[model samples]
Target chain A: MAVAADGRAAVAQTAVAAESRAVSSNEIIAEFVDVHRHYKMGDNVVRALNGVSMKVSKGDYLTIMGRSGSGKSTMLNLLGCLDRPTRGEYRVGGRDVSKLDDDALSNVRGHEIGFIFQSFNLIPQLTVLENLEVPLFYQGRVGAESREKAEYLADRVGLGQRLAHKPLELSGGQQQRVAIARALMNDPLFLLADEATGNLDSNTEAEILDLFDDLRPDGVTIVMVTHNPTVAQRADRTLWLKDGEVEKLVTNADRADAAPTEESL
Target chain B: MIRDTWRIVRLGLKSLMLHKLRSALTTAGILFGVASVIAMLAVGEGAKQDALERFQDMGVTNLIARSKKPAETATSNSQSLWSALSYGLLYAEADLIQASLPTSVVARVREAKRPMIRGEHFHTSIIVGTEPSFLELTNMQVREGRWLGDIDDRRLANVCVLGATLTRLLFPLENPMDQTVLIGDDDRYRVVGVLSEQGRTAGAGSTPYDECMFIPLHTHQRRFGDVNTTRSGGSFSRERVELAEVKVKMPSSEDVAAGAQVIRDLLAQRIEETGDVLVTVPLELLKQEEESKRMFNIVLAVIASISLLVGGIGIMNVMLATVTERTREIGIRRALGAKKKHVVQQFLVEAGVLSALGGVVGVTLGVGLPFLITTWFAQKTIILPQHVMLAFSISAAVGVVFGLYPAWRAANMDPVEALRHE
Candidate 1:
C-alpha cells in the first residue's frame, strides 16, 4: 500500500516541479504541489488524495473539510510531515520536505510545524510546564529561555496559573489550551491541528475556535483538518475534498454567502 | 547533551515507577544472580586462602619423607613377632640425604607415643625427637626460654621443648620452663622451652604439631629404643624404623623440586622393592589445589551467570510489554520532534536503569551474604572488591543486550499508525 502511494506521489511530484519554480519561497509558509496519496487494500487501490495542489501563505487560516475517507487525514499527515507524500512535492517554510528522510522530516516537524490534536495529546506524565518545553527539549534548546517562553505561551493560552497541573487534571477546554500553548512554544512556522475541537463540548469548541481566530491576526498560520462545516465556515478559506479529489475551494466571501445551514444537510 | 540524558533518565524512571511490583520482581532476578556470584566467589576464595595458609605452615620450600609400612608386607605372619619387621626410613638414609644436599637443612625426626607426667598430672602425647634444624624447617616458633640446643643434643641432655597444648596440659598453673616432666614410667626431662600454637593441621600427611612435645634426637634415641611394639586383638605387631621422618629444606624455593627428586632417588635406590617411604612436597600440593580451585570457580561462575541470564530475560520481557503499552506515548514523542534515536535512547536508558538498580541491590546482598555466612555458619568468606564489580558490570551489560530488541521495536513504530492506536 505504501509503495503504491509512493508511486502516485512521485508522479504528482514531477507534474508540479515546473510550477513550484515560479512560487516565491518568502511569502509561502507551506505548498503542496500536485500531491497524491493512495492505499492498496487487498486487490483494490484506494486513492486517498489525487493531484491535490495548494499553497498556505503567511497569516493564512486554512481549513480542510471532508467526510470520512475523503483524504483529509492523509493530507494532514503529509502537511504535518508525520509521513511523506507518495509522489508530491511538499515544501514547508520554502524547503522541499517531500523527499526528505525520516530524520530530516522529524527535524522539520520539530522546528517548523506544531501539532494540536483533538485529544489534546499533552503527555499525562509531565506537568503543563514540561509539556510546553518538549519541542525545545527535542531541539536540545531546553534552558532558562525556553522556560520563560513556555511561561509566556501558557499565559497567552490563558493557562498561566495551571502550569504545574497534569493534563488529566484539567477540563477538556483547559487541556486544549495547554496543547495550544505547547504548539506555540517552539515559534513554529505553522500550526497543524487535527480535529482541534472535535472532543470538546459546543461551548468549549467555540472557545477553542475563538482562540484560533485570535492567533490568526497575529500572523500565526494555521491549517486545520475537520469534518464539521460550521468549523470550516470560520476559516479564511475552506478546501473541500470528496472521493480523493478537490470538490471545491470556498473563500471567506463565498462561505459567508453560502452559510451552511440545516437545509444543506 | 547531559541535560537531555538526565531528562530521559528521569522519564524512564517515572515509567518504571508506574509498575512498581513488576519492576521490583524483575530487579530481584538480577539481585539473586549477583548475590550468588559474589557468594560463590567468596566461598572459593576463602577455601583457597585456608588451604594456602595450611600449606604455608608446612613450609613450601620443605620436603617431607615419611615411613609407611607396605600394605602387602604387613600381612606376613612373621610380623607378629617382635623385631621381625625391619622396614622404613633408616638412620643411614637421613645421613645420605644431608650429605648429598649440603646446601639444604636436613632434620631427622623420630616419633613415639609416650605417657607424660608432671607431678600428679598425667597425659599421653606424641613425643617428637628432632634436631635444631627441625625448628626452622617446620616453621615452629619458640614462645619462651630456648629451643633444644646443640649442647643438649651433643650431651644427650634430658631437656624437652613442649608444644603449646602440651604446656597447657602439663603446667595448668605453673611455669613449664625449668620444670621437670616425667616421661613413660621412670625417665624425667626438663622443659627448656615452649612452642607457639601451630593450629590443628598443616599440609597433607603432616602431623598436627600443636599436641606433641619436642626433645633432642640423641636424647630420644638413648631413652627409647628404635623398635615400637603394639598389641591389638590379642596379637602383637612390631616395627623397627630408625627415622620416622626426614624434613629437608632447600636453600631457595627454585631448588626445592630438584632437591626433592634427588632425595627420592636416593631413598628409592636403598629400598626400591619395599616402597615403604612416601615423599610429600607442599609446593606440588599447593599447585594442584590451585588448579582445582580454578575449575571450581569456573563452575560457580557459570551457575551464577545463568541466574543473571534469567534476570536479563525478565528485563526483556517486561521492556517488550512496556513498549507495547507505551505505543501511544512513543507516537506523541515522535510528533514532538523526537528522532528514532531519542526513542531508542529512552527505552535503552530505562532498561539500563532497571538492571543498574538490580546490580546495586544485588551488590548489597552479595556483600552482606558473605558476612552473614562468616558469622552464622562459621565459614570463612572473603569478598573481593573486583568480583563484586565484575558481577555488577555483567548485569548492566545483560540489561543492554536484552533491552536492544524491545527498544528497536519502539523506535521503529510508524508515527502515523502509532498515533492512530488506541
Candidate 2:
C-alpha cells in the first residue's frame, strides 16, 4: 500500500514542478542559481554545496532534508541570508543578495527572512513581547505599529497572555511558539527554520507541526531544514540533498502516502 | 534613531541587572575615583584662596624695608654691654628712601615692647611709633575720638591711639578716649583715639595690629629714646635702632619691583659692615606663591587621573567577563538582525550607564565630603561646580575608553561559532 502511494506522490511531484515552472518570475520569493559554497579546512578545500539550482514561490512550504555531511546547514544559512554563496546568484524578493555587503545582507535578514532555531532561540533576558520586536527593532521600526503587530502575532500563536513572560519561564513547546511569533513579526518573505522540532517531545512536535500546517494555507512561506523524515513529511514539498547535490524532490502526495498514520492524525 | 537608542540602552540596563553584586562592585571603582578627584581639587583650591588672601593682606603693591640684627662678627664681641649694637633701619635711611622713590609713599615705624599700665591693670604689648600717614597706609580706621594730625606730631603731644584689645583691657567699662595710660614706670599718655576691631587674620605681621598701641613718632622719640634694652639669662643686650620698618607704597604695581631694587641698592651702600636691612616685596612673593600653587594643582590632577585609570581597568575587567558569559546572547542578537555596530553600541551603552550612575553618586559624596572636612576637622575646602563636572566627565570617559576592547571583541564574534558555544 505504501509503494502504491509513493508512485502516486512521484507523479504528483512531477506535475507540481511543471506547474511551478509555468509561474512568472515575480511570483518566486527566492531563487538559487548554480550556487556553490566552499570552506577551507587547513590545507583541504571542502565543497559544501556545488552547482545546485532551485526556486521557492510565494506561499510555498518547502523542506530541505539531509544527513550530517550533506550540506543542508549550508543551504539554510544561504537561504536565510546569514551567509552568501561562493560563486552563484542568490536572489531574495527580486534582489541579488549574494553580491550584497554585510550591512545590506543584515538588512535583508532583518526585513526579508525570519529564522527559528531547534533550541527555540529566544533571548533569555527579554520577555516574549520584546523577543517578537527584535527583528523590527533592527529595522528601526519599533513603535506603535510594531507593538500592535507583535500583539496580534502573540494572539495568533496562542501566547497572548504570556507576552510579559520570559523565555526561560516557558516550556519548550511554548518557547517554540514564541519563536514562531517572532519570526512572523516582520512579515518577512519566508520563515527559515533549522531543525524546528528536533528538541520537542512527540505530542509537542505534533502540535508545532499542526501550527505550521495552519499557517501554510494563509500564504506564509516556510523553508525548513531538518534530518527527520517524519517532520519533512508535513511540508508541501521536500528537497533531499546528498554529498552537496540534489538527490530527490518529494511532493505532498508522496509524504502523505509514506506516512498515512501521521497524515490521518 | 533616538527611540531606538533608548530601547538599546534599556536592553543594556536589563542585562546589567542580572548580576547585581558584580555591577555594584564595578561601579564602586569609578565612584571612589570621581570622589577623590573632586576632593583633591577642592583642597588645592582652598589652599590657593588662603594664599591669595594672605598676599592681599600684605598690600600687593607695597615693598617693605625692615631692620634686622646682624649676626655678631668677631669685632662685635669686643663691644661692651650697654654700648648697644646699632644695626637696623635708621632715620637717615628712611630719608634716603623717600628721596630716591619720589613717586612712592614711605611710612617709617619705630616699634618697642613695653608693659602698659592703667591703674592696676597692666598688660605687656607692642608700642608702635608712626606718623599720621601710617593709618592711611595700613588701611586702619579710628572707632572713637580722632586720629593724630600733623599739628599733634609737631607739637610733640603725649597722646596715643589704643588698639581694640588694649582699650578693652585698660578701660573695661568706660570709654578709652581721653583716658591716661602709663608707659614703663613714669611716662603717661592720653588716649586720643581707639582703633576698630580687626579680625584675627587681619594682621599679617609678627605682632597683630589689633593688640598694639600707636603713638606719635616725635613723642616716642622724646620719651622712650632711640635705644631699647633687654636682659636675658644674666646677659644684657641693647639695640640702638631708630626706625624698625619702612613701608614704601609704589604709585603703581609696575613700579614696585624697580622701587624695591632701588631701595636695596641704597641700603647696601649705606650699611657696608653687615647686611642689616631686609627688603621684602609682597608683590614678588604673591607671584611666586601663585606659580607654586599652579604646580600643586597640576600634581593633584595627575594623582586624581591615576585613580580614574584604575577605575577604568576595573570596568574593563568586568566587561570582559560579561562578554565571555553572554557569547550566546550576542549570537542570538546577531541572528535577529543586529549589526556589528549595534552589538558594540549595546555593550558600550551598558558600560556608560554604569559609570554615569557611579559618577552621580560620587559627585554627591564628593560635595559632601568637603563640608564634613570643614566642619569636623577645621580644614577649609571649597567645591567648585566645574570640579564636579570635570570629575564626572572623566569617569564617563574612562568607561568608554575601557569598554572599547570588550565591545570590539563582542562585535567581532562569529555568530555561528558563538551560538554553538555552551
Candidate 3:
C-alpha cells in the first residue's frame, strides 16, 4: 500500500509490514509507510512528518531534497533509525522495527545501519583506524580481524598511511573520507548520509561522489539527504518532500546508463 | 568480557589524557584524604606503643609503695627539728608487705645521700641499698659482672653495683669492674657490676635508676646506721629512716588487684594525714590507657571519613562538569550505535581510573610519611597493611559512588539534542 511514490524500490512487495506479514523483497532493505511524527510546543501539536512514505532498495544511490519545514530532517532521522515513527510502520530486513524497544532498536542500529554526517563527527581523540573500528566495536567485533578490515577500509578511502593520526590532525576533506570509511565498518544494509558533502568544497565534494560511485559496483547502497542540486543529481533518484509529504521522486535518468566520469581535481 | 572491559578502560584513559592537568587537579582531593588516613593512624599507633612500653617497664603485675614525709612536718617546732625528724617506711613495714603476699617477690630499699670518689673523679649521688630481689622486681639488667647475691648480703661485703650514669661519671677512662669507690671519708665499696641504661621509665625525663649506686641491704644498715645528720648555719639536725620503698611483684597479672587491696588495707594508718606510703599499680594505668586509646581511635576514624567524603564530592563536581562539556561526544557515540549502558560504562571507568590513580600515589605517600615522621620527630610510627588496603579500597569506592550521578546523566541525554549541542 506504501509503494506508489517510489515503485522501483517497492517492486516485489507481496504482504503488509504493518500487519506483521512482510513479503520477501530482494531489493528493499528499508521502508517507511504512512509515517507521522509530532512535537508538542505548549498547547499545540506540530506534525513534523505527516503521513510520509518511502522505500530504499539494495544498490540504490538515492538522495532526499527539500526546503526548510519540508520534513527533510525528519526523513533523514527516520531513515538512519535514530528515531522510530510515532505512528505507522518502518521495516528493515523484512521485519517491522518501528515498535522495537530501545535495546533491540540499538541492536538494529548497531548491526544494520551506517551513518555519515556533514560535519564528520569522528571522536577527536581516536586514531583514524580506531574510528573505523567503532561500529564493529558495538557489535563485539573488535579483534584482530577487525583491525585488518579497518586497515583495508583506510586504504580503500586513501587514508592507509594516516591510520594512526587523529581526526584533528587531518584536513576537512581527509577527515570526511575517514568518516565515510568508518560508516562502512559493519557492512550495513545501507549508508545513511545526512548532508554528506554540505561542509566540503565543490572540488572535494566531487571526489567524495566519485568514491560513492566506486563503491556502487560492490552492491553498497547509499541514501543521502542534501539541499545541493548538483549533489542530488549524482544519485539514481531524488525524493523531494513538501509539507511532510512526497512532493515528487525525480529519477536521474542519465545516471543509469552513463559511464563513470573522471573529474580532474 | 575481560577483553571488552580492557578496551573500554583503554578508551577512558585516552579520553582522560586529553585534559591531563584537569584530571590531575581533580585527583588531588582523594590523594590527600587517603594519605592522611594512613599517616594519622600510624602516629596514633606509635603513641600507644610508647605508652605501652612505659607501662610494661613499670611492671604491670607489680605494686610500688614509696615513702614520703608527712605534710604537717613542713613547719615542725624549730627545737624539735634539731633533734630528729624521721617520717617514712620503717624496716618493720617492709616486712609487713612481704608477709602479706607470700607468693610474691618483695624488694626493700633505703636511700643514702653521700659523695663518692674514684681517684680524681668525685660524684655526689644517691646510694640505693636493696636486696638481691630488687634486680628482678625492677626489671633492670646488669651490663657487666654479677649482681649482688645472698653471700654478699650475709658477709656484709663492701661490694656495689654502679648505675649506668654513675659508672660513666666515676670511671670515664677505666673499667669500673672491681674498682674501689670511697662512699664518704669513712666508707668505701668495690664495684661489682655496671648497669645497662634504662630508658625513660615513665615519661620525658631520664630514669632515676641510671644515677643510683646500689649496695647490699645488710651493708647499708651497718655503715649508715639509719641516721643522717646535716650541719648548716651553726645548727645541726639528724633524721633517721629505715626503709625508702617496697616493690612487690605478683606471680601473675591476675594477682595484682587483690594484692594492691591488701597493701591499701595494711598501710591505712601509716598513710594518715600525709601523702606518704603511696601505692602505685601499673596494671590499672595500663587498663585506663587502653580505654582512652579506643576513644582516640574512634575520633581518628571519623576525621578520616570526613576527608574522604569531601574528596568524593570533589570527584563528583569534576565529573559533572566533564559530562556537560562532552555532551557532544556522548551524542556522537550514541549515534554510532553505542547503548546507554555503554556510555555509562565509559564514564564510570574514567572516574574509577582517576581515583584509583590517586589512591596509588596516596598509598606511596602514606607509607613514606611515617618514616619521615619517625626521623624528624623522634617518635615511633607503625604502618599496618590492613590500614593501607582499607584506605585504598575506600578511595576507589568513593570515585564510583560519586561518579554514578554524572554518568547516569551522560547516558540518559537525548541523542539528537546532544548532537546539536555547541
Worst 10 residues of 2 chain A by lDDT: A256-265
Q: Comparing 1 and 2 by DockQ, which wins?
A: 1
Which portions of model 2 show Cα errors greater than 4 Å?
A: A1-26, A254-265, B200-205, B269-273
Q: In candidate 2, how many Å is residue A165 off?
A: 1.6
Candidate 2 lands at a TM-score of: 0.92
User: TM-scores of all models?
Assistant: 0.92, 0.92, 0.86
Superior candidate under DockQ, 2 versus 3: 3
Off by over 4 Å in 3: A1-27, A256-265, B1-4, B69-79, B83-100, B202-207, B225-242, B254-273, B294-305
DockQ of 2: 0.48
lDDT of 1 at B219: 90
Output the number of the DockQ-best candidate: 1
Which is better, 1 or 2, measured by lDDT? 1
Backbone clashes in model 1, listed as residue pairs: A9-A86, A9-A87, A9-A88, A10-A87
How would the candidate models be sorted by lDDT, starting from the highest? Answer: 1, 2, 3
Q: How far is candidate 1 from the true structure (C-alpha RMSD, Å)?
A: 7.4
Looking at model 1, residue B363 earns an lDDT score of 95
Comparing 1 with 3 on lDDT, the higher-scoring candidate is 1
